[model samples]
Target: MIDGLKPYAEMKDSELCWLGDIPAHWRVKRAKAVLRRIDVRSSAGAEELLTVSSARGVVPRRTANVTMFQAESYAGHKLCWPGDLVINSLWAWGKGLGVSQHHGIVSTAYGVYRARDASGILPRYLHELVRSSPFHWELQVRSKGVWISRLQLTDESFLNAPLVVPPLDEQAAIVRFLDHADRRIRLAIAAKQKLIKLLEEQKQAIIHRAVTRGLDPDVCLKPSGVAWLGDVPAHWEITRLGRLIKLTTGFPFKSDGFTHVDDDIRLMRGINVSPARLRWDNVVRWPMSERPNFREYELIPGDIVLGMDRPIIQRGIRLAVVKEVDVPSLLLQRVARIRVRGDLNAEFAALLLSGRNFASYLAPIFTGISVPHLSPEQIKAFRLALPRAEEQQKIVEDVTVRTGAIRSAIDRAEREIELLREYRTRLIADVVTGKLDVREAAARLPDEVESAEPARDEFTADEESDPIEVDDEAEIEGVAG
Candidate 1:
């Protein structure tokens, strides 16, 4: 998967628009010419549900990470077999196409296809070729819709698209080679991810110490009478969340009243709340005309917003602090706005809630497995410790500096992972497009490549296992990118 690898011994111009050249013996064909469409729908409306992802191939939705829109029934869902191909119409441009290794059902919106003749092409080989940039580019061109990014890759369009096919044996060799290479790359990525996790933990350690205790190493300490927390500064005060903050629940805004237009006030949903921040990229809006007295729902600087549903992710709470740019936004149901009373410092309160102590308490109270939910009372019941006004500001300022260095390390590690992902994408494009010869490399792989090993980093066994119920909002809250 590098520039030094030799190209095919002999090559010819394939004369295809996306694919310029290929091995002389390889054949250039339309997707439909080499594949037949599969249109079998679930007669019983019951089957193992499946999902398609950018990195991982099609896997059972029940055994995959949380996905969007879990259907109440699969009655109209299309049936797909182990060797078939599935393409997510809306996100095909983002590498949302793959070959399924399971016999299950998928949403009707997806396009399913079976090889017209298996003897002529390998499904695994086609999987890589389809995911390669050339095919992705072709799909984008064939996609038809009003929005450029969200184009639809309909059945007819996807089937008619072009593909480059190598002989069956060579195709097998390519899959084996790429698989070995991918495993190696994924392992490296996993190590980087571990490093990032460590850095984050280091940052959190600083915050936990500063907020729970105090900045002074020799400060007199006393027990707060809480099991999770050991000792706090002798001068600090202990209180319930009800005493230190004013909490307001978001209104239940009607769905039909929602709009994407600019004239409306942005409605902050559970999706907008991420760990310690608000992501504005995919927010829905409330029409200013039909909106109720939503001004009361408007957020202001220093207010902390937390998702009432599935607020805990990987054992940490998700909080978003309102900034000037984030103002004028109204909160929607299952989300709550928090404002600290004059007795508690706002910044100190946010840091405290974002810590592990807050999450541990909520974990036992929220009952749902897939979709966790919390009542307003459960939130107010939290035990909190407060420092004098001046001491609170000192702790916030000191913790900020202490975590800054650790955060820098985490950011650098994250960037490395992104670069590695980009490289892996390019490597696949080069290999599938006949830019590199990996026959020798594929044959030289170690025996462990064939053994069952958990894919790490962005993908993992836990991430790909049975229906994860955290609450309906978890699906919207934890989207990758």
Candidate 2:
């Protein structure tokens, strides 16, 4: 795409420290001069409730993950019209602001603004500019707070920022060019994601068969006497999970007491659990203290950690086996840690919890509610199929080797997706800041440029949710608009 693009006819300095050069025809202006704050409040609280996500931008609140915060009445929330810019005040430093495409009621915590003059300033253009990589650093610097998590973007700090103004027609062209480029990139990623899902399903089928029935396909079968288990090897035993495992609750650490540091005590939360294994990215920490009882909470290699709250992801719940790299960490509240005892093989138990068959056992425990959770008793009461100890170990080893190949393919696809997303970000920064002129590219763009329409109201029964473009950066930053 870059090879086919051309540069501008003329150039000039932007007169801003952060922004270097720009097209000669464009002018540099302070953000305050181009936009004004809007503070309209809905008296009837009738507008659709909306959320701001770094991944999906300003969307209906229910569409995005509200696992962290339950939805309440939207009364007294700030009102926003389509084309207005909405900023997640606390997370603006992470580019958690976007142009709204729906008329809705946003949390009072957000800052809403509209263009003072649409002829020289467009909401779409402004959205791309403020979210550009350069602006991320700029917002971080201007944000006011003592710590990173608590940083806030005040109206005075946000509205006074620098902006580059272009002709309205040029803004529209750039938006169209980027929209078309973004859609193509997303379509490619969707294909890779689909492939990964199929591979996972196949891997689960392999696990379900091995863990339930013995290795020999011709082995004699007998009724397991459990409704969920139709028939198992004649020699296998049907046992309760409590007979072979000891379940422990996670430590209830105070959130306000938490600190951020590399060497501090690592706290494992639900986010660390992945389908294939545990992930250490985005770890939270607690200060190292003198309490000796901490040793009891510390995890050892091969210990089982299961997410107990809002644990479901991508239509399934995933469990993790602690490795040496993940040790020296204490589990946080809303997570369950299991210790193996008696004749059960720990590896086999962990894999069983990670399989698709486990979903049926979990279905009843996860009643539709604001926060879905499983009690310790419910986990212990789960029926377990016990094969010979030697057979259990062999099955674990066999499944590991088989699933490893599937995992490898998924990893390769994920890396490619990451690289594609990086290219998208760079392309946007180059074109939006005048480093690259895509006017010709825009003209040649396909006529079906994606519409930047907000998803349907999640609170309504008659509406069907539309697929929205999820920005890759949303992962690094927590959540934003």
Candidate 3:
């Protein structure tokens, strides 16, 4: 589309297939020609070992799985240096590759390779090339065995693979452009992540303020003397949960009671409870014969349900509100259904259950030898600071408005992230699969290549090295230190 390059569509088959058409002066080579394997063992000592994280790449070796404190000696581990490429042999398929920038050792499980000629082939460009789908497909096809769980790239296979080489200057320019684009995308992602965190924190702050202090801040206040809730509005009453609501446990429903029926009835389980909402995707239906016993467990549109599983409680489970589709839904035995009675507001009660104040109150009360649980009596007897019906509605309305805005922002940001990821994948596919020509694409770059000359020496394998053993104790000590 720009100048100095032609489209791949006009090129003949003899010119190129995988990379479309490139400059006639360009030559294709194998990855092994530019990468040299480095495998050397280190003594078992106190040297810090580095780990490769899928998200962070090569970081300080302290986080490796081996113990670092007790080992008396150090032996055999592969040494890595700055500009060297390290990859977990078992996880290479997942893109567990990193360009190291520090002097350290890696476990024997990782493969370390150095660029044979940095000027001839840019390391960054090669790294990006290997990650492309075309290169990965070649690796997959050359891999042995039906299952590629522990596949490693053989030297022969690596040497035989074809690479699309442009002039050295053009390769460097392409790398620069890609790095800039990648940095921009990463910054955008980080900004979105920070916004999501701020929204979440704001949501929690709103709930905490509303539950602890009534909608009318100018109202007379007093010390409730309760440690969990420091103080309450003077006019508000502190009452036990038993007095304000009805707490009941659901009857035991076995797997035999489940049925695949076209009915309105659904059985609510802990799995149905998700973050801030309910998921009925795999919900099971219950028979009508068992409906009466579950009447007390029947969830209403505004009722709040809590998981009674001790582990779930320990993991900080929050109460969820029910909807119309969940009206006929019956709760399982390990779930507690709380229904507001008299003049109490159901939405307000649900809000209290959803907030930090209620969670802080209930966290300590849950106790057990093996599995912690909350009894019906305990739920009923729990203390709560209650506001008048009018004030409760006001607090609920305020929280709904604030939290609704935050939820909407999170939803939109998540969608944008998805779109960006899709665009990145499509771009890579188009470039790597010959659907687009890199030479023509390079013409759209901000700068043109300074030279069309190729480097002198190509990549070649160095002398083979022996496998190294890593000290388990020193590795642990490094992490603990």
Among the numbered candidates, top TM-score falls to 2
Model 2 weakest lDDT span, ten residues long: 459-468
Clashes of each: 11, 5, 20
Clashing residue pairs in candidate 2 are: 52-480, 52-481, 53-480, 53-481, 54-480
- Residue 71, candidate 1: C-alpha displacement in angstroms: 5.0
Candidate 2, residue 232: Cα displacement in angstroms equals 2.0
- Model with the higher TM-score, candidate 1 or 2: 2
Q: Total clashes, candidate 3?
A: 20
Over 4 Å off, model 3: 1-27, 44-48, 61-75, 117-119, 139-162, 214-229, 232-398, 428-481
- Candidate 2 backbone overlaps, count: 5
Model 1 root-mean-square deviation: 5.3
Q: Tens digit of lDDT per residue, candidate 2, span 186-228?
A: 7777677678778778888999999888679998889887777
- Residue-level lDDT of model 1, residues 335-427, one tens digit each, is 889988878888888888898788767776765466466778888888867888999899999988888888788768767876887888888
TM for every model, in the order presented, reads 0.78, 0.87, 0.54
